[model samples]
Target: MAYWLFKTEPDTFSIDTLRLQKVACWEGVRNYQARNMLRDEIKLGDEVLIYHSSCKKIGVAGIARVVKEAYPDHFQFDPDSPYFDIKADPSNPRWMMVDIEFVRKFERIVTLAELKAIPDLENMPLVKRGNRLSVMPVSEDEWQTILHQE
Candidate 1:
């Protein structure tokens, strides 16, 4: 299975929230590049690293598994929803989402600084300069290297 890293603001939806809820609908992705990955690449059973971004303790907080594959992001169709897209049509969805189930929470965060310090992870998108896609693919080698830090 492929590996992925999904970034989220802790204040918005943290690893703790995922741990408590057990499963979460990973939605509201507005970027077309990220949306394409969600719709075309990510699949059920793929592992994920829940990375905390836009927060004080920014890092990879835990692991999750894609329990459900891509489906139309319903929020894009709800006028009252913040994620609503004026141009999105129900007949042809523009955004997609996946369902991820909490797998394990790391004992301690694998900090961004720590990740950047590792030579093996230098090629990882998350560690690259200015690479800010909410969803990013992680190579199997990168995945294992990061996990080893836990």
Candidate 2:
């Protein structure tokens, strides 16, 4: 199965929140490229690195699995929702989301600073300067390397 990394603001939805909910709809992705990855690449059973971004100590916090395929993000249709998109139509949605189930939280946070220092992770998108994709593909080697750090 394909591997991926999905970033969320810890204050918004942390690994603790995922453990409590068990499963969550990964929505509110506004980037076209990120949306396409969810719509076309991710599938049920795929593993994902749950990352905490836009916060102190940004890095991979836990593991998750894709529990549901791509579907229209309901928030995009709600006028009151912060993620609502006026251009999105129910019949032909402009944004898509997936369901992710909590797997396990890392014993220690693999901080972005730590990742940046690792030569093996040098090519990782997360380590790249100014890279900002919320959802990104991860190679098997990259996944293994990061998990091994735990």
Candidate 3:
């Protein structure tokens, strides 16, 4: 199965929230690249690292598993939704989403600084400057490296 890193604003959709909700639809991805990953790449049974971004304490907060395959994001059709798309047709959607179930929160967050320090992890997209794609592919080695880090 492919590995992935999914970035989120902790304040908006924290690992704690995922734990509480058990499973939730991962939506509101507006970036074309990220949206494409959701629509075409991410699949059921894929492992996702939940990275907390746009917060003071940015890091990998937990793990998750894709429980459902990609499907049209219903929010795209609702005018009241923040992610509403006027150009998106119901018959042919412009946005898609997947359901991820909570796995387990990390005992300690793997800070970005720590990620940057690791020689093997230096090539990871998360450690690269200005790389902000929310849904990104992760090499299996990189995935295991981060998981095994203290």
Q: Pick the lDDT winner.
A: 1
Q: Estimate, for each residue in 12-48, the C-alpha lDDT of model 2 and write its tens digit.
A: 9999899999999999999999999999999999999
**Candidate 2: segments with Cα more than 4 A from true spot:** none
Q: Can you write out model 3's per-residue Cα lDDT over 1-150, one digit (the tens) per residue?
A: 999999999989989999999999999988889999999999899999999988988889999999999999999999999999999999899999999999999998999989999999888888999985999999999999999984
Instruction: Give model 1's TM-score versus the native structure.
Output: 0.98
- Residues 28-139, candidate 1, lDDT per residue (tens digit)? 9999999999999999999999999988889999999999999999999999999999999999999999999999999999999999999998888898898969999999
Global lDDT scores for all candidate models: 0.96, 0.93, 0.93
The alpha-carbon RMSD values of the candidates against the true structure, listed in the order shown, are 0.6, 0.8, 0.9
Off by over 4 Å in 3: none
State residue 27's C-alpha deviation in candidate 1, in Å: 0.6
TM-score to true structure, per model? 0.98, 0.97, 0.97
Best by TM-score: 1
Cα lDDT, model 1, residue 56: 80
